[model samples]
Target: MLFVSRAIDKLNDTIATAVSWALLLAVLICAGNALIRYSLNMSSNAWLEIQWYLFAAVFMLASPHTLRRDEHVRIDVVTGRFSRRTQVWLDLLGFVFFLMPVCLVILYYGIPFGLESLRSGEMSSNSGGLIVWPAKLLVAVGFALMILQGVSEMIKRVAYLQGRLDASAFTKHAVTPEEEIAAIKNANHLT
Candidate 1:
């Protein structure tokens, strides 16, 4: 189980990095397009359409890693005050009641929608001209990755709750060198 979780984490990290770079590229492309249109008096319909597609890809590909890293926005007003055990229970409840159901629904519908688009050879209506099927397929792929990561998280949490796993064994947080340096600097400043 540890090996599996580690492998999943590695995969998620790779995908997240790729997605981040893709988003950066998208921003550069959009900036360049704007500059060309304003400064050069040239417009590109293709650039505009491609920007949207890249944005979609960036979000879709990064979602699973965001969940794995607990980076998603949450109210946390209440959960932040809870004990570790209570927080685990809250996470379990939210996962079973909310996250799982939503992912299942997306997986159910997204597959057929993407398949139909592929079958019909769907293309974007944008003046730039783009294939729609690949973007549509990202819906299913993203949800599937989310589901897998959720399962890994659930297993680790349940193991911790059952006393079969040490808290440190399942805990994901670790201080990086940069954070340690920052902490030391702050302490020195206080002195």
Candidate 2:
């Protein structure tokens, strides 16, 4: 179980790194597009479409890594009061009932959606815009990766409950503002 979890984590980590680069590329493209549009009064739909594609990829592909790192947003005001074990159990339930099912449904629908787009060789309406299939396909790929990460999380949560793994390591930890400030100070050598 641990092995599987680690493998999934590693895969998502790789995807997340690539997606991060995509984000940087998107930023660069945006800046370049703006400069060209204003200075040269020229722009290409291809470049604009590529930026949108990168943004979509960054959002979809990086989500699994966020889940793996236990960094997904939550309302901690209530969950904070629960015991750690209870929190783990709740998270396990959420993965089983919510995250997994949601991802699976998206994957179920997304595959055929992408396939149809590919079969039709769909193109963006804008002249010079990119083909639509790859962006359409990202939805399925993202959810497939998300499902794998959800399974990995569930495995770790169960392992923690069974006392086979440390709960603290697998669970989310909320950082306080003071801790955030201290980290910033340390990074700047202000402490």
Candidate 3:
């Protein structure tokens, strides 16, 4: 269980790092587009569409990372006061009943949706816009990653509850999303 959890975490870390690039790229493009539009009075649908695509890419890819860090908003007031075990159980139940099902349903529908878009070579309604299938693909990718993280979390919680895992190994002492982002910025010399 520990190995499984660690592996999932490593995968999400790698994916999140890659996904972070989309944000940087999106910002640079947006700034450039704004500058070009204001200065030269020139703009293209492709550029605007690309920005939207990048935004969606970042959002979709970042979800697993958020879940891995347990950074998603929850009713902390209710759950925070519970005992640790109870909290874990509640999280597991929520995922099982709500998050996992929702992700699976979206993933199931998303694949065919993207595939049909690809098959038909779908494009945006705006002239000179980018192809639509790639953006459509993000839906399945996002939910799949979310489901993967959900399973990883459930495994860890179950192991802990069964006395096979250590409490410290979970969110007790973990590097947060903010810390990770700061580290990435520092590594890139952005600070």
Top candidate when judged by lDDT against the true structure: 2
* Per-residue lDDT of 57 in model 2: 98
How does residue 54 of candidate 3 score in lDDT?
92
lDDT of 3 by residue, 79-106 (tens): 8799999999998899899999999999
List, in order, the clash count of every candidate structure.
Answer: 0, 0, 0
lDDT of 2 by residue, 1-191 (tens): 89999999999999999789999999999999999999999999999999999999999999999999888987678888999899998899999999988899999999999999999999999999889999999999999999999999998998898999997656567788999999998989963
Please give the CA lDDT of all the candidate structures.
Answer: 0.82, 0.92, 0.89
Regions of candidate 2 where Cα sits further than 4 Å from its true position: 184-191
In order of appearance, the predictions have TM-scores of 0.84, 0.94, 0.88
**Comparison by lDDT, 1 against 3, better one:** 3
Clashes of 2: 0
Q: Candidate 1 vs candidate 3: which has greater TM-score?
A: 3
Clashing pairs in 3: none
- Poorest stretch of ten by lDDT in candidate 3: 167-176
- How do the candidates rank by lDDT, highest first? 2, 3, 1
